[model samples]
Target: MNESTELGEDFKCKLPNVSMSTQSKTMPMIDLKVYIRVVAAVFSISSATALVMALLRLLTPNLFYVEPLDGSNIVLHYFITGLMVVTSAIGLLNSCVVMNRSAAKNTGRNITTWLLLDSLFETTRVVYVFICEVVIKGRGSLQTYEMLISIAQYLLDSFLYCQMILRH
Candidate 1:
């Protein structure tokens, strides 16, 4: 037999009665769907956690030791928290659709980038709050305790962003 005939026979034996063309088309879709579902679940959990934290802060403003409860603070808190949740949800949904169609090469990258950006924004906001609470409007110059806490938060944010970049 010729080389092509031998190769064909080997392929058929390995695959048994399965059609190569159908397997090629269906397996990828199945894998893509699974990947999308996993990604969505992860982002959904993160968003929910942030929402819960925001709710806690809103309800128990005194627990934060930041400032008096006011309208502007409430509005800004809700807005930022809501934006985080919404953006994460949208990214997950977009990823699902793209992966479902097996055309998410760039979409996945964009989602990752967006998530990183959101994390960075949160970090900045937290830092600003820390500075305001500990330095400018704070009592006296600065409390060592408050400074340590702010520094810790900043470190945590940096670590999170680094992880995100590495994952991408």
Candidate 2:
């Protein structure tokens, strides 16, 4: 055998050098739809929990020994909290829609507006709650820990929705 043949045989066990093809950097599965769906699920759950807690407090006012709060203020509180509940429900539905679309491998752009609106609505609710909680004078017992938690859920949902717009 020639010197070249012997050299090739000596390196027969080595693999041939194959250059990697250039692949366009695209968003991974977990980055966009998957990530937002997961966040949406958690956001939905948090909203539901906060809703239940707020309802419990509202129904059982005597449990906390809350003094008689202003009727108008109570009405406003219920209105905002109820709006939050509806917002959370919508978020949950949006997540389900996203999951279905993802399973079909065809996520659409329709949800972008909904997500943006949810973020705005939730932010408004959270801000209202924060302002009320700070400005209100004497309904300390009614505004229990659950109120803060409920507000937190709204905040989290708002943040998630805002983030989802970018991903969507």
Candidate 3:
């Protein structure tokens, strides 16, 4: 009877090794959900910052004195702000889908690619703004400083993205 009991204990221990294979099936889903949440948070914070910058420009006209707020500029301002809000909301929804396991691995990969692309575009936009302020507008306003700060932020974001990609 003691020999049988010992054998049963050994079998139970080995049973866990058999169950380990099933755990891998759910691990990717959990990892995808976490990645999506992290990306969504990044987008949310970025959108909030953009909104704040837009509002500051609207309230303090002297900060960017070169271009007067004409009809076209006002429209552009609102459009950009709307874009930020929309992107953040879309990211949040994507994260929800990932969390629900409705999003495939390919979909998660695509989202990650899009995020990196967006970061690149943002970097380009900052560089363009900085160039415009310094070369076209003679670098006389707070916009130049803001552009420099934005460039630094974009660099930091790129660094973080690289780290994430490498870690994954």
Number of the top-ranking candidate, with TM-score as the measure: 2
* Local error of candidate 3 at residue 90 (angstroms): 8.0
Candidate lDDT values, in order: 0.49, 0.59, 0.54
Residue 63 of candidate 2: its Cα lDDT? 44
Write one digit per residue (lDDT tens) for candidate 3, span 1-168: 999999898887443446545756764544644665565456445444544554565566456656665675556544544454455345345434434553455364766665665564465445445443554442337676666666665666566567456445
Candidates 2 and 3 compared: the better one by TM-score is 2
Better of 1 and 2 by TM-score: 2
Instruction: Give candidate 3 regions above 4 Å deviation.
Output: 1-36, 58-61, 66-108, 136-145
> What is the Å distance of residue 46 in model 3 from its true position?
2.5
**Ten-residue stretch with the least lDDT total in model 2:** 20-29
The number of clashing residue pairs in model 2 is 0
Superior by lDDT: candidate 2 or candidate 3 = 2
Which prediction has the highest lDDT against the true structure? Answer: 2
Q: For model 2, what is the error of residue 57's alpha carbon versus the real structure, in angstroms, after optimal superposition? A: 3.8
Question: Between prediction 1 and prediction 3, which has the larger lDDT?
Answer: 3
Candidate order by TM-score, decreasing, is 2, 3, 1
* Residue 91 in candidate 3, Cα distance off native in Å: 8.1
